[model samples]
Target chain A: MSEAGVSTLEIRDLRVAVEGKEILSGVDLTVPKGEVHALMGPNGAGKTSLGYAVMGHPKYQVTGGDIIWAGQSVLGKPPEERSRLGLFLSLQYPTAIPGVTTTNFLRAALKGQGKELPAREFLKLIRSEVAALKMDQSFMSRYINDNFSGGEKKRMEIVQMAILKPEMAILDETDSGLDVDALRTVADGVNRVRGDGMGILIITHYQRILDYITPDRVHVMAAGRIIASGGSEVVAQIEESGYDPMLRQAGIEAEAAASAAV
Target chain B: MSELISLRPMTRDDAPLAELPGGDPDFLHKLRTAAAAAYRESPWPSSSRDEDWRRTPQIDKLDPASFAAPGSSATELPEYLARVLEGPLAAIGASHTVVTDQAGNVPTAGGSPRGLAVPLEEGLRQDPERWSALLGTIAHPGLRKFVALNTARLTGGALVRVKRGQTAESPVRLVHGVDQRSAAFPRTAVLVEEGASLTLVEEWVSPEGDDSLLAPVVEVQLERGAHLTHVVHQRCGSRTVVQSTVRVKLARDAHYDLRWALLGGAWQKTYFDVEMLGEGSESRASGLCIGRSQQHFDVQTLQDHIAGGAISDLLYRVAVAERSRSIFAGLIRVEEGAQKTNAYVQNRNLLLSPQAKADSNPTLEILANDVRCTHGSTAGRIDDDQLFYCESRGVNREQARRLVVEGFFADVVDAFPQGAVREAARSWVLEALDELALSGALAAGYGSA
Candidate 1:
């Protein structure tokens, strides 16, 4: 976790869609490595599309524009290729695989990165990570997210991010449905793995998660584009006035600048 | 093919009764002779034509005459076959072991015939009276072609008897080694005396080649208050075609637990029938099948409750990948007046290849309203969200899919006969995954069929 490093993720004029319906239009964003950027927007502002488009999800088609990770473009790669290239996405909704365990999934990810660990050392790491997440040891042996509660799924995503040790992780609404206690615990998990040489882009609809992990930068998206970005003052203004005023001041829906560009 | 072993599609002229070994009473020979004549009477089952076989509708075009059912001399097993047999034994060390390699062949170092375990033929020769009584009423020859064939050309069978008020020191392990390109008809008869208990682990192996055809018929009788746990593990090569039928009769207060681990084969068809004959009887059946490539499996089962106060539960999980396919059809039948009967059946199938296909058909026939019965069947692909969750963690799509598929099967495999059996199952699954990975199937196989 390099707090002050040079690795960067620059998204210039990223346009994305799903089944020919455009979602993200001309979205400009940049998260230099070693920094936490809070991405806040209203319900239908295409906030999730950016996270998925950057992760190279097949469903989130990138109709135009570039996603620069480190120094090269990765717009055409598969999700696995993007993952191996140090990009990660923590889905708000994780799929349940009936019999696959977290331990095996983690091992598979490590192998994908050309890394293998001794069983003893691997167990030791798993034990420590499980404890850090306040999860039972049995959780590692249980099937991945199979019938898991909302909080358990959140903790699972955090544990995976911590273990996979990605350089940049696009957390798509990681705090969506969690209570305050679980939210704090998951926030602490993010903070623990925060400064380990990776850039953090926290996408959310509420300001609660911001209370724990203070963002170095805050970007507001509306209708599909990043209409405003600034320091923590932007978050304070949004909280004080709500997203309506911000969208109104930016004239996001009048001319529909985001859609017209697409 | 030998004259005694390779009698292709039975003609009335084929005289199997005179070829089989043993000096049983004339009635025994008469039964075999009648069975052979019945084999000639029954027509071959066509998947596309027969009502009972219509659900699966998929099978290998195997020639019955080309395969042989040669018997061994009851001596030491060959190294290759022994190597396959020893893995399971070492994993689940046996209290008594028996093999059908040859005459005087001691499958185990010190298996006692006087007590619990004995060779099939020796047990038949030693107590010709009891073995005949049980085999006399097992599978009927005229009911189906495969049954008739197995009855007409039976070889290399075993009998494990747990006497009353006695429990085995360890599981009685039975291992069968079939030669490549030959057909073998094997049978197992398990008789648990009243209040007796035994666990039998029977394994079938054919070395890695498309060189054998295996057809087996098993009969289990659980007397009043008797208990038995039978685990059948079949892991033959994909080249071999295997079809097995198991029939069981549970008496009053008797409990029978049967589990099948169908891990390998090019073509596999299996059937299981359990009849609860008296009150307070119970049975639990479970199985898991993991297949890839061009493998095909046709699985069916029937739970017939003839008396009151009997309970039966069964679940089977199947995973098919590549161009493979699986068909599962199960039924729970509660006879009229058989009230107070509780039963449940479920079949789950997973598809991982675009070309892979699966069909799950679960049915119920309840003539008694006082009975409680339910059946469920589902065929689905790997969850997209789960696959994404895995891939998002830096695992490639292929490995992620494989992990999810293995997880799908672990639910059924992990809970049974926990120690060595579970470990062997996991190891077998990994071996299969390795084969799939090396063939470039992990990435190239998934598609919507």
Candidate 2:
């Protein structure tokens, strides 16, 4: 793959497997600095698995390719190490850590990133973020994702993303369970953190979020591979024709190439 | 009161008894009789190959022969308990009361309207029949050997009683202060009449120079429609040894809330046994313990659901540092025919140092199929993610860890009764954290990246 522009993340022929089953076979993606890319796919298309594999989740094994972040191979690094390297993942279902308050959890994450802000500064940052997200001030004292509503939890993920200020972020299905108002609010939070130095890969099954935060590039993933890649029109096509036409095109192209090789 | 009985002389064999003053006629007689009986009947718990005592060799380490009763005139009690009693008394429009010098002395000042606090020996002499009857009714003879020993040889303790339908707006603080170089057995019996509400704070402390052993027993009974909040703060000196047992019974529609703070003591073992004996009774028991240096603390709890439709929830958390060790063993038992009972027991521990160890065993035995009962025990080091999350925000490793540990124990601490008692516990926990930081137990830049 050619390294053009400020490519913060480069996924080359990335293949991942879970429980002896291959997913994301030979998938290639790149998120250059100051750019937003949306990976849109149908249900069970391994869009979430790609985010997990890139973030170095232990369960998602990279069976074939390499994930390069900031010109360095990050395949062997653990999640915390990758986080230190300025990588963040907005999980669709954030794990609830009982007895850990949201403020305390965010503070730890910030400290781990080697940006240990002073208490006053940290509280200021969190208060501003919470207000920007329209979260109740009392939410700071609540346990991390414990007994939180779906929208509240999603907003918390955005709050974490903003506070951590990661160089690259992989948001996996962040818009799945949100209402229109909540979706807009979350998108606004995401947009506030978007800029020239940050790259965001928004993985979604619906095109609602794309309307709020437009993507420069959209890729359609099917059957563990990126079958089609194009500009923002690809999302509109997927929204219109659904995955059947693209599945047919991918199958035809694979069969033709196989027969020609034979 | 009976005449004081003097022992033969102060010998190494009779050292334990010599710790108590040779005065107080009634207390002396009770001590000699109980000590003689304990020496003759109950042999020292065998440390040889006994399964329960094998790892914790009870007899090998303790020289029971040399253990003695504590003295009468020792240093003043810790200021925390003092402030607790003084603040509430003034809040509820009570006059300044004279603080007692010894645990047995009753404070002589403005009279408390709702409850009565009397020394155990005084209560026994003033009304032996009533005191003996109440003691016999509550103290079971077979199960707890320590309670039996305490009952037989008990000296000075508090007898707090709340009259029927009377609700004391202020909490009654019972400060049991032990003297230097003495072993004190303080027995407290609390009785709440029907429709009465009372809050009792039992603060156990040893004098500064005291290396005494405090073996106290507290028995509480709540009548129908009664409400009681019991807070036990065990803040003895580092050289002090304390083994306390609290047994509570709740009647119909009675509620009991207990918050224990185990912040001090060289070796402390507390057994909290609660029984929901009447239908619709509720009990909440939560505690926070901090063990450092060579301290070893163990808390054994049992929530027995003997009646139907009773609810009980318990949460206990401990933070261990240095060579300290903590063990929490909790059991939730729902008896047969006790239907619709809800009970949950959870214990979480944070191990700050590699050498610091924590053992938790939470068990549930449900005989009634309709009952909902669950118990869980978790022991883990501080989460790397949590630590990193704190550090990345500019909190040094120490402060970040302190916050995580504070959060870990906040679940229990927050449940403490709202007042000075809660504040005292909170400050004590923070002090322990500061000590942990000063000792360099928290490593620098420890969170992974």
Candidate 3:
């Protein structure tokens, strides 16, 4: 965190590798508090790796460059500690924890961020958030996404993001595999929680979610680094064309080794 | 019992005249004498030689003489034993405990209306005939060396008998614990008469202390149409080696449900032998064992279908972390004339650390036609993907693992018939996980944010 404790994530030429193959190569991006940016990219553009890399997933190595949070380098910080620093990652696929209820997990997650609420108050807040996301109350007691359907898992991820209320949340394909109804509900929940000193980076290949919770800025990722950056207009352009224009314009140098998957 | 009273450190010669523990019964005394002779001639069980002990923790030595028992008094009892029994899981309303004072010759705890729970010595004194018929009748000695040892040297014992047509609303809890560094043998005999039903929880524990050996034996008899819900929880000290035997018999239309939860102990050997002797009888057994550090666990189970149309299902789960190890070998034996018998056995082991090891063998022996029998087993470690998912939520890596491990055991905990027992198991598993985290055994699981 910065000396003044301001919320700002500055990624300067960050290079990340997973199992000897680099995913994010010399990438630069900046997310100031209270701003939502869209990271538009295709399936193999290393978008999820960037999100995990930002969250400090151990499997992802920051072989080069630096990820500055506020003013401190958070390259070596563990996920939970970095979470306490107000960073969050909403995974594309939220896993099932057989015996751990969503309510208990959310409570523990919030506590890790140093936010302890009375039981009654916490219950009230969770209930309100669950209702706001159009989720059934029973989901609170069910195992963490154990048997949740595709759409339900996406909504659950958003619900967690709402409860944790981190300063910055990296949404990794929260829009994929979601129906129109689910997309609307997830976008509604994200919009409700965002714009309150919380910065968000929504990673997706399509402009479907952009049609709901509009992003202030859009960046196209090709190969490993950002090839194009612009305002919301980039979203319309990407929708009109696709990653093909960006992928074609930015030729692959192949500086990093390839042919491996994490 | 005279020869066993105040016997110094156990010795090979003490095998002879190792009669009934509570008191001298001519019938049991004769059987004990024969077991003594058998113990001398029985081959020393080895993991390499005996299939039942194949995966059992290697015992470099057996020194019954090196064991010690606590002095006879509540004052002399260790505080940890008291905390373990009375603290987390307070004694239930219908609870039983043998007072160690006066050589544990007294049944200090109360019992239920339909049941009579008393110390074996006190029971024998009050009704020798009844005690004689109930004790040492089902779990015969000399079947195994440890069983023979327990049958021969048991110092403290208790018996519970549920009358006919009685259904108990609350569990009859029993606390078997010790606070010394001696080989303590606890023997229990339970009889559920025809049409009687009750929930029984037997907890055996030994807190932090010097190296010790504890060998407990239990025999349960379920009469025709009887229903018994039995749960066993064992948590021994790190230096202790525990060898326990459980034998159960189910009569016509009887229902037996058994659940076990185990933790700790340097080396643990537990065997549950169940026999369905009557038609239409049914039994379900489930167990959960969590081992940390360099602890080793060897659990062997057997389901014998002696009569036709009986059903038996058994499942055991083990979670080992650090350099701990777990071994499971279970068999479902359908004897001749046991046609149409249905039996299923399964074992699942979770290895939390790379060094942690597990071996499982769920076998079936069908000697009759038209019988349905099957066995399945799986051994694995925590999914790194799941670990990463939990860590992204702000739970520290260790905390994340703690959640996943507890989740792994949640199914069994939730399956308990009683809400109180379910809650207790859940919290106890979490407490054990927290303790592991404190000891830094789960340090390797700390997930990078």
Candidate 4:
């Protein structure tokens, strides 16, 4: 890879462990400004762990290696600091805060980043975003993710992404629980916010979401490490032959691999 | 039930019971005389020994005799009290309101139930027999030490009554305030005659920086087919201490809905006794408490199903910060032969600081063979996952904690009437959390826990 620049996030042989068990073992990757990288793997390839580690989740301990963002080390920063530094992580299963309304949560998030909008302006912006996402207006009043459908949750994540306008976002299986229509709407929301040199890493198990938002680079992970890296050919190869051929090529059996780590 | 003889005869040196105002009816005098005897017979509750006072360490230090006698009516309302009246109280549109301060009372005449709803003293003088029979019928002086003291020193309170077959459009407000280094014992009696309905809001407030003791007792009687909505809002100064009890009885097919908000006091111990006396009676009780600074709160509630086919539901929530402590103990008792009874009790506590402590205990005593009863309690800190979720969205830990705390109390407050009452409660919760944040308690939330 080219020399890491100020507008790039470099994972230098990144290693992460959860509950004293290593999940990501010596994985290296880089995504430059304005580029969308697709990180795909089979059922348990530690794809989500990479997103969490990069965002500084307390449970996802960085046992070794370094994560450099914007030409500075972010290993010591808390998750909020990481977010303030223009990083976002779309959780696969968003937590439901029972009584916190969606609009209030978004407003607090904006204020945390020193971008607080006036009440009327904020409501106007949220209304436009909700309309664009084909979401119901009542979503703003409902508790965040409480009793929401799986598709609605995925769309809600995208709505936050659109509002937050982060520099770098890691979408962890955002397309896992969406139908065709919701997937398109979610993909459109992500694409609309993919401006201002915002880099994205979309993690997925299926190639369907990639059909809408093309990836600059596709990387396959196996046994807690990236086994292969290429362009659209990687997506086609995995879609046609599945991950068995790639797992065999990397000299690792598919089922025996201990990648089922959260 | 302990046999403890009085070392001295009842006098002003021991308490203010003997100094009660004269010209009272024989029943009123005899009631106070009997309560004084009971007060002398019982000793102050010991924190270590008394099961009910186990979690309350402040109870052991209480000395009611050290404080001044019960307050006289106030001639002028303080600025703080006036502000409250012009704000939340005025918006409530109470049909009858009587505001009491340390000096005296200022009663406002409303649309209906004019003479029927008056001060407790006036009510007693108007109908001595009726007032005598209703007073202390539910919250008997023998119930506890404080109850006896309250009865002996009872001076000024509101007596709100709705005649049979009448429905009051607005609430009846009994607003009481106390001064620094003083004591207040306000007794309220709310009577809803058969097929009548009424709404009552009792607010007890103390000015900031005051160190006082306020003990209030409330008795509620809902006759058959009657409906009553009762709201008790207690907001005291940070240095004040409080001991309060509310007793409610429901007749056949009667309904009692309650919202009890305890938001202040340096140390507070409160009791709620809801007895479903008649068959087909129903009760819904919701309570919320926000504790900060060095505040201590111990709230106890009982849902008694005395008759068959009654229903009772109770939910209480508490949030504590700084070095505050909150304790909740609730019991649902179903008597034998009260078949087909349904009861539910739940208590949830949220600790916003490592130094903040909360303990919740929910128990059930069902002697009935065919009854459905459930009880559960939970005490916990903010969920790490939830905090992380908010943090990942650029919200700091402190702000995230405020949101979580607000969300924790929303369900209970959301059930309140959607107007001034609910808005006032919501603002108070926000203000309390802001205070906690200012004290740097929110910074110590995720550390070491």
Candidate 5:
């Protein structure tokens, strides 16, 4: 009942709401094999809400939609179940679990996915990843996301994504509140994880991230629906002109269609 | 088996227990008479609608008719204890001293002080002047019926004294062996003089197939500027019942640290009462309890701040598996005019099975305006998200659960004093975990020690 592709993720007519308020309305998106799609939307445009709904966050209710992943329906699965289905969402605000170290947390997640790396090999991978992210090795010993700086927290999210290596990855505002160097390092990590088997959905309000990790297709979202779809040039246009012009154009088209129907 | 059946019922007529070297019959009589009077005047603690004893209903099952005075000598310790003492505790110059009855005996190591391991009857006979002021003062005044019973019927115990300005480099270990199928009451009293330091460990063990009752009372006194570390390990047999009470008194500028590890017992109840009676005193009390099967463990603690400028901190961790249950109740009281008193109490429990149960109550009573006091209690299971996170990394479900449980208790384990005690405790904990894993109660892939 869904489009066929080598890609594992298919979001069709996805409508999401939070507490009886529609945040994402009739949003149709597709992330095919070996491609990265950047979702650009201003504040309160339902960017993060979409990411949460796609990843099966309990709070984000999908009133009307279906998420088909890898030829299977994943709409009713829990977060952990979705994770096992090769879907991952890097949270904008990671939760701090005291008494649980990052190393242990990742090891559990990996084990849940039916993969067990030896302790030494696991440590080696973590060390290399930490080095690539320009993070200290001691961070692995600390509690997960406990008392971490903003940039360090972002790097931790990327590190988790790299280690988990899900088939479809959604980064929720990963570039927000990061300095230039930090942002660049995060983008590099994301780039390293990108490949033919992986499809990334980078959600952000700013276009600065596009400069580091260019997307094959840029989708502009306004008031919950995808208003425009274009190449990388659209990101520059939105950065220069903001959402007002495109929002006005969308409104004009809606009125014209309504008059013709009457 | 014949010896166990042929054993005569212990009574007051059984010749008075032996005295320590330089043995006073008069002082012994006086102590016995006073304790007997206290027992007669105090009523036993009953579970008939009383608030404190309601949750622990087995307290009322103790029939006074079944209790007999402790006999002289009767049971053998398990081989595992010998192996443990030789392997870890021995490395720190510590040796085990087992007391079968009132016959007070120390190991051949010859490092222990002459009067350190004296029995209660011996303390009364040999050193009445030094023991009289300490005998009943530190313990509560017939706080519970069993405590009164212990004072009334005690035959033997360990009397440890640390001289002024002296520090024992190694721990002094005492094993209180409760034998026979009847009630046995044992007592222990310790005295640490000014500027002296000592570490004392007491273990209560019951041999296999012995369905016995043990009521124990222990008192500790810390002189001005003295430091004392006390650890109590209670691991009775599954069919055994035990009731224990420990009271500690700290003088000005003295420091006291107490750790209680409850591992086994069919039904066990313990009370820890620490009284900071002098200014500038500090006390730390920590405990860990693990219960499985139908075992029940209850711990009640009180941190009474009677003097100004004294501080106390308490932390208790409990884990329950199978159908076992654990209860922890802690109260910190800062008396009026005890200004600048700082006290905190935290109790955390982990439920490993659906049938397992845990109840934690942490209370603070502050009568002073300028004091700082806080108490918190938390009961939860392993975090599902954390478990999934670990499992996703290739750690199986069981191993993931084990890691999470270990992490839960790591905060308390890290607080243990360094060296042999800490190592021994860690090894024992790992052994318990391994047993669970092997029994398939825990998941596979979690390696054992």
Candidate 6:
């Protein structure tokens, strides 16, 4: 509603397509600095597509609308440029890069951001962060997510998020494979790194993670459009009754919209 | 041995076959004479006809006679060669170091008991019986045209022998350097006696921009219960052409390990032949080659299991950029009675550019039903998902590609034996990547940042 602020990630009438198939029809959302927003949707609701589009993935083409960050449309910008502009996307399925150590990759990422630190200092930072995540010290020397457990891979993503310390973070399914203990650790890691100046966008389908990371605002999407946005009460509403009640309230056919989203 | 021989330019017609060095023993002269006859009899390999030479073109254009033999071995060491001797090779702390260049065979540093390390001519002169018995046994001139040429023109060669039941604490290095318009032939003979173990590094290098030819041959014989580690490093100038071969034979219970690093030269072809001749013998071979520009690198390997209960494993990797090309061909053969033999060969190639080309062919022949033999070959470009993963972490596309390329070599380089050698190779690989970037090949081939 308000003009996009300098420190906010504003998606206005955003339309995205993948392989000529339109996924996100008209998604509008805004996450200003110092706020945590949760995007809840059923399977194939275009939530992951929105996260990738915001990160400037080459495959997720923007058909219309704009993704304005810092008061500038980030259209046509390459993924690396957007990353350097303080945007982070925690992939749902992070690919393994063999022969690349976690420390070396993280150091390169930091150097790319012009935050190069001395060798000893960088190791110290990595050691402390890895320890904070309750990961083994040997994890720093192992290849990036190579042969890592499911929980370890999820923690590795959070580690990158913490080390890069981006201005805005979009976590896609960070709680999907995590157990109770791992979910708590990951939630604590997020809370620790989510400073006042950093904006957070958590994309999840369930209400369990919401209990750990209470969101300032919650939005629900169906058929590529955000149907509802309000305080945390929206979460309770969805928890009490399934999306059918919400679809009924919104005058949209639940099955048709759900399958179309698929 | 310290007195350098005055180098004289000789064409193919005047190759000194008639006037074999008078001071040499009868066996030495006979070997040379026989090799000379073989050189004249065999013709250069043709890519169209020889399956092993199919990937290598312009074989007829290489005139070994056009380039003069390495000049007076008295020439001062170049800055680069001197730095190498003082750096990684020096850090290896060799038991004996021999530098063969225009300056001749210079014993730069180190020593071994009972004259374990000496010039090839001196070694043959000292114990003609032992030298003659080992020479031509593995890398005989009749094997190939280039081998014959190397044997006929062999100069500035070195011999490293570890006596029986002795274990050398450090390695022996035979470093060879060539000048522009000059050819170098360095022959190395390694003999590890029964119960003895040693490490040998044979290196060939030249200054940048030198259009030269370097043909080297190495023969290794490991006696029963002996162990040996061999490294053949070739980093010649970009304009130089290289043809090299290493032949190794293991006796009963003997072990042989080889690491061949091919990082330079404009056009290069190399061969590795390993024979496990006795029960309980084992051989392992691994190498890496990084090519840029229009350079062509072809490597062939043979693993022959002659005795039952022997094992041989080979792994070779190549990364090519620009219009460069690389080919890896490997074969594993098990004899009829070699029932318990186990052999494996794998070749992996990374194409860093659309124009860059790589070919891998790994074949196996098993005559023994009880033998286990497997071969695999792979050639591919960097995965798009991998690239995107790095890019999303704030690394630019170019840097991301570089990281992926470096990671591609990390496993191979880490497998190098000595710590110094491994570190040196890691730095050189990084340096090669930097050179590729500076030449605009990375930007031109890989997408721009």
| Candidate with the greatest lDDT versus the true structure | 4
For B194-248, candidate 2 gives per-residue lDDT tens digits of 9999878777776556576777888888999899998888877888777778999
State residue B425's C-alpha deviation in candidate 5, in Å.
3.7
For residues A40-82, write the lDDT of model 6, one tens digit per residue. Answer: 9777888988998998887788999999987888998877888
Task: Please give the distance, in angstroms, between residue B285's alpha carbon in candidate 3 and its true position after superposition.
Answer: 2.3
TM-score of model 4's chain A:
0.96
- Off by more than 4 A, model 6: A1-4, A245-262, B1-23, B69-71, B78-80, B102-114, B444-449
Error of model 3, residue A147, in angstroms = 1.1
Cα-based lDDT at residue A223, candidate 4 = 79
Per-residue C-alpha lDDT of model 5 across residues A66-156, encoded as one tens digit per residue = 8888787788775667777778887776666666788878777777776669999999988889889999999999987789987898899
lDDT of 5 by residue, B1-449 (tens): 21232244433322122223233245544554555556656555566767677678887766644645444443343353444345555555553243433223323334333545554555555677787788777774456666666665565677777889998777777766565465656778889999999888777766556577777889999999999988777767787788889999999999999887788778888889889999999998888887778889888899999998999999998888778888888999999899999899999998877777898888988888899899999887776555544543345567766777777776666566678777766665666677667765565221210
Error of 6 at B62 (Å): 1.6
Q: For model 6 chain B, give the 10-residue run with minimal summed lDDT.
A: B1-10
Scored against the true structure, residue A42 in model 2 reaches a CA lDDT of 69
Candidate 2: residue B420 lDDT (0-100): 65
TM-score of chain B of each: 0.91, 0.85, 0.91, 0.93, 0.88, 0.92
Deviation (Å) of B146 in candidate 1:
2.3
What is the TM-score of model 1 when looking only at chain B?
A: 0.91
lDDT tens readout by residue for model 4, B1-449: 11122223334324435332334466766777778778878877888999999999788778776666444455556776776677665788776777665443554434232465787767777777777888888888888778888887777677878899899887787888777877778788888999999878888888887578888889989999999988888888887788989999999999999998888788998999999999999999888998888889999999999999999999999988878899888999999889999999999988777788998889999999999999988888888888889999999888988888899999888867668778877877787788878987776535343
Candidate 5 docking quality: incorrect, acceptable, medium or high: acceptable
After superposition, candidate 4 runs with Cα above 4 Å error: A1-4, A195-197, A253-256, B1-22, B78-80, B101-116, B445-449
lDDT of 6 by residue, B1-449 (tens): 21222133455533443222324467756776788678877666788888888878757577777876454555456676786677665677776777776434654534342367777767877788888898877999799877887776776578888999999888887788777887777788889999999888778888787688888888989999999988778888888898888889999999998887888888998889988899999998888888998999989899999899998999898889888999888999998899899899999998888889999889988888998899988888887777888888898877888888889888777877758877877877888889888886655322321
Best by DockQ: 4
The DockQ-based CAPRI class assigned to model 6 is medium
Q: Could you tell me which 10 consecutive residues in candidate 1 chain B have the lowest summed lDDT?
A: B100-109
